[model samples]
Target: MTTHDLPRLRPEVVLGPALRTGPKTVHHIKDESTGCFYRVGPREHFIMGLMDGRHTLQDIGVQYRETYDRTLGPDSWQQMFTLLGRYQLLDGHADAGVLDRFRQAQQDKQAARQGWLRRRWVLLQPDRLCATLAARLGFAFRTGFVVPALALIALLQTIVWTHTTVLAHDASHQRSWAVAVPLLLVLGWLITMLHELAHGVTCRHFGGSVTEIGLSWRFPLLTPYCRTDDIVLFHRRRARVGTAFAGVFVGLLSLAPVTLWWWLTRDGGPGHRIAAALLLFGSAGSLMSLLPFLRSDGYVMLTHALGLVDLRRESYRFWRLRLRRRDPAARDTLRAYPSGDVRAYTLYGIATLAVAVPAYCALMWVWFARLRHWTGPGWAVVVLAAETLVVAGLLLGAARGRRADRQAADA
Candidate 1:
């Protein structure tokens, strides 16, 4: 194409807000057609931003020169065009190479589908539902409602904390432990569904799409999830943060009625025992979601606030490189990132390891203790062996994921 020919980006392509990592500002470009996300630096973003079919290459070059006091040569222009074309980001037909790569990606995705043990069941497309809910429930996002709700939750939590001993006594004396436990589990699951919906509704309220609301099962764990990835495209950081916090907020809020019930019927009864147990379990779960070490609401909020993509992966990679100080190939890995990012990665890696190691150890100890009591010593040993195999499988999976991430970054 000639310099005067206009280049246009695909209409469905979405450009995310500028996210700063270290000294560089990066922008995310999502190709809705392919469901692929690409990150570009400020210069590429500037060039792509003008690809509206109205600005010719000459016009873009002129603007670029004016802004940065630099001119792009013919080769530079060709390279930029090639990169865009390879990703099929430009409007119109893609070349054979791009089509082949796209086909291969599709095949890879098919091959990588989860097995029966760890599966995802997409219940429904929740975009329309979320939009409707957001409209009707818009007032809930207002400060007038939020402030009082938070205060109520705080007060209820304080009451629960103060009456912990009495609640425990009631729970122990109750005759319906077996029935109440199962009922509490069911109630918790229902609240979890609402929690996912809350995330979708909040994203919709902030003008973001909630494409999927589904259940994901990874063996022993099955939970409802809402795909709020479109929140990244939002210009307002608070909107992104709010979307992340929505699930946890709804989870904690669900305890309000149960807390009230427990307070009113402090008399040692089955109903009161159930209510007390629900309060304790629900509160613990909600608070656990606020720990940044896990891929939970707190982690999501941290990433959004810091504008760092894949913080956990990056931190892990940083530590891996740091530990291999004698390896020449690994030495350059840390140098690629800016000093600020390197420091961030180092600190996060250390903090996560410090917390996660002790926490996991304690969890395993408790697991073994429980298993020993429930089963025999021999059966507990067998169960521990099975658990070890599961952990090994998880580590292998993580390794594969890291390799894939590195390949993507290189590309």
Candidate 2:
């Protein structure tokens, strides 16, 4: 099917929440705002069981003996539907289609307004911001910027990758040119081009034709990727590996001479030392390009090694598998093609959250704790409460979304 024909999601998938029950199946329903999904068995069971609407949840559970030949043994259905309704899945026992039009209208409004940007960024193949400038600057200017601009550009590189990854990914498919152009400019020109070029050059060197570059989405985030969809053009693992590592490799190799100069000239008087320091930081920036979890070159490298078409989706699928283990009777519907490194992606995700979220909290707690030692307990309590609330809101949004999504899918 053409892209549009391939189940362009109902507005509900975007504005409404989504409940995914399997790899390809998603049940979408309207929430007051945004969207959500669920992959939990208890939540799904509660939802599918209630959507039957034959009886009150309590009654259903009572006759659970009759329906499923098992005993839910309690009035959990009322509680379950109540909670689902609170999450905006079931609305106060109202008419079934009551809010359907309202939700659809909101989605239409959003699409009408936002679709311009989406179409520009996702449907049209546009030149990215940096492509012209980088082409103009050529190798000489790039070499000069390599020393002083690397660190600054390295920071820019991260932002560039974020934008370019999304833009280029879409552009590869003749989509998302508008989004790609702006993001490339915002990210600065040279690094973004380098990033895409890394993909193209590597693919070309590996005997794979670089058909296109554009923006794409990895669920919650956006990135640019090259269309080496013709990967089979080269059979050797090194070709594939090299193509994948090309971007980070370019980042590092581009900064190599400066790094050598810095090392060689470290003790060479005042000017030399300063130049060396700049070179050091610049090289360091190239190194940052290699980190995997933060959507840098490193992450793509891992995707290649694992041979998964999309690492993030596979990662989430793997995470969902853990949730599935909690409910054996419920089916696991998660899907990813060439599902390599699923466990690795799962562990990476877990370790990432474990390290990032708690570390951030603890760091803030300690900083505030020390400040409180001087400012008094009241200030400390206020800060702690504020932090707690922020975290709670984020977590609640996630949980409610997941629950709502599950209920809708089950329905």
Candidate 3:
């Protein structure tokens, strides 16, 4: 706090190359030691820049007053230094225990996960060697690659859809669930990896580095996802949107080979059966992601499009506000956003949940009935009831998991 006390920024802390988003010029603060990235606006960047060995804290405050015509408060100074120190962005001298607190926070996070979710196992990263492989594959994001891909997908889908029949049937048509189940599971796992890869590669193509490639649990369901927090630094909406739904696009593209092979082989053959199972599961899962009510790719895309991060929560509050006759106690958070966003949230929020639930239940029922090869109407009804209960249980598990996560954080 003394005028003579000159604090130095850590040599390893690197400011970004100055990205422009909207009206502000911001930089991504990257700590080379921790591999941590944090976003800061121009003013915050100025504060950090002034942390050179020459300028003391008092001098930095004077500089801030000169620049903004107002004295910088102690709270601002505390927050900035606390963050910088927590991330180890400052040199030898900072609040002595901030780094310790940061380490404790990380340890607490690790301790919070109880039984089945203690750790995530990362499967593979093809680009670990030759890191520039993704950069070279940037052409894949362009129309030249996409248009041909789309054409091929259409051709393969057409093959699966129409004019196909069983020709030379195998004698071993006794439904091999034992072999098929394991094989299908492995195939699905790889497909999930492919989905995450699509996101990572798309992000790299759009000039963001892939931080981690791994598998993580989505509530009770184990799903694969990639971390590209660098997307926050990506100023363009197109880049962010492309990164968001890249998995969904890859899911769609994968159908080409599965559908084509299914058509080429005999209907009763193992290849046909495996392909059918994958197609069913992949299609259903991707469709589920498209439900805007749920937190999936489609919802992410919609949220980014609407330019509202809290669309679902705010929209619910808006509706609640209306239902209670504009009660002052209820938060009308959506009112601050643009009129377009308000309307979009209002329509998408309620309508998506209302329609998607039954629609999902119907899809599941049909899928189960098809798998069982149920012939009678009574069997179909039973399948519907079973599928509905399964969906409900999964939903309840997700809700409980979310609550647990929040409680852990609070604790």
Q: Is candidate 1 or candidate 2 better by lDDT?
A: 1
**Better-scoring candidate (lDDT), 1 or 3:** 1
Question: Which residue pairs collide in model 1, if any?
Answer: none
lDDT of each: 0.80, 0.49, 0.67
lDDT of 3 by residue, 1-411 (tens): 542278778876666535432223457776544455566787888888888889988889999989988787879888887766556777875443765565566546645654453345566554452246576776877899988987876665455444333211221232687887888889887787778888888777766667567666754566566776666555577777788888877877887787777666754555777777676667667767766754677777776665554456556656666577565544343344456755775687679678977887678766776766655766766767786788688767755775687566445
Q: Give the TM-score comparing model 3 with the true structure, all chains together.
A: 0.64
Clashes of each: 0, 34, 0
lDDT of 1 by residue, 1-411 (tens): 742388888887888888865445788887766666678888988999998989988899999999999998998898888878778888874565765677578547634656654567788798899999999999999999988988988887788778778766765665667787788789888888888999999999997788788887665577677888787787888888889999988888988888878877776544888887778778878888878865778888887877777678777767777899679877765566777778778788888989978987888788889999999888988998898799888867856765875586557
Q: Where in model 2 is the C-alpha error above 4 Å?
A: 1-196, 203-240, 267-273, 329-342, 365-381, 384-411
Candidate 3: stretches off by over 4 Å: 1-104, 110-133, 158-178, 207-215, 218-220, 266-270, 310-325, 329-334, 356-411
Summarize candidate 2's per-residue lDDT along 208-325 as a digit string, tens digits. Answer: 4454566655334466656543343244545555666666556555544544443455444323333333334434555666766655666666655654444655566567675786
Question: At residue 311, what lDDT does model 2 achieve?
Answer: 60
Which model, 2 or 3, shows the larger lDDT?
3
Most lDDT-accurate candidate? 1
> For every model shown, what is its TM-score relative to the native structure?
0.84, 0.42, 0.64
